[model samples]
Target: MKITVDLDPKLVWQIQSEAARRDLTPGAVLRERLVSSRNTLELENRIRSRVMSGMCDADIAADLRLVVGTIAAVRRRLGLRPNRRKPGWAA
Candidate 1:
């Protein structure tokens, strides 16, 4: 399949430069970016679901292979209270 659309020359140059730096074609760079954005959305959805399930940020982050701070930020943005530390838990 082939499609064509006009992009600003600067944007095209940036994409081409990125492709060269990554040793990939321009189209592959674009596809990688699209897939990365979709994956990020999916990750956020999983984070929201886990937070709603009363999972602590540390647990969610561990399960999702993400940093705990990222999970904490998302939890805060969703207007959820921080999880209480478990009894005898030490950090």
Candidate 2:
């Protein structure tokens, strides 16, 4: 879903600068901001609880009828690491 668009050089520089300052890629920063603006508190809460309970973003996204990136965006906003292990699987 990536589209090429012309952006002012100054805006691009600002985005890159903010990204570096936050230790994130420019795309991550943009996605985080977009998701934060669009997602509801209840939806965010659901994602948070499921993520904390060890659900992977794909599974949460599937169950919630949302994109995996959206789940990831919400998870990042919650400051949680990506879930690597599947739920209920012994290590």
Candidate that scores best on lDDT: 2
TM-score, cand. 1: 0.63
Looking at model 1, the pairs that clash are none
Q: What stretches of model 1 exceed 4 Å from their correct place?
A: 3-10, 74-81, 85-91
Predicted candidate 1 versus true structure: per-residue lDDT over 1-91, tens digit per residue: 9989798999889999999998999999888888998997887789888777667788788788889999888777778887765654333
lDDT per residue for candidate 2 within 12-45, as digits (tens), equals 8987999999999998877786677676777889
CA deviation > 4 Å runs, candidate 2: 1-39, 85-91
The TM-score between candidate 2 and the true structure equals 0.51
lDDT of each: 0.82, 0.84
TM-score to true structure, per model:
0.63, 0.51
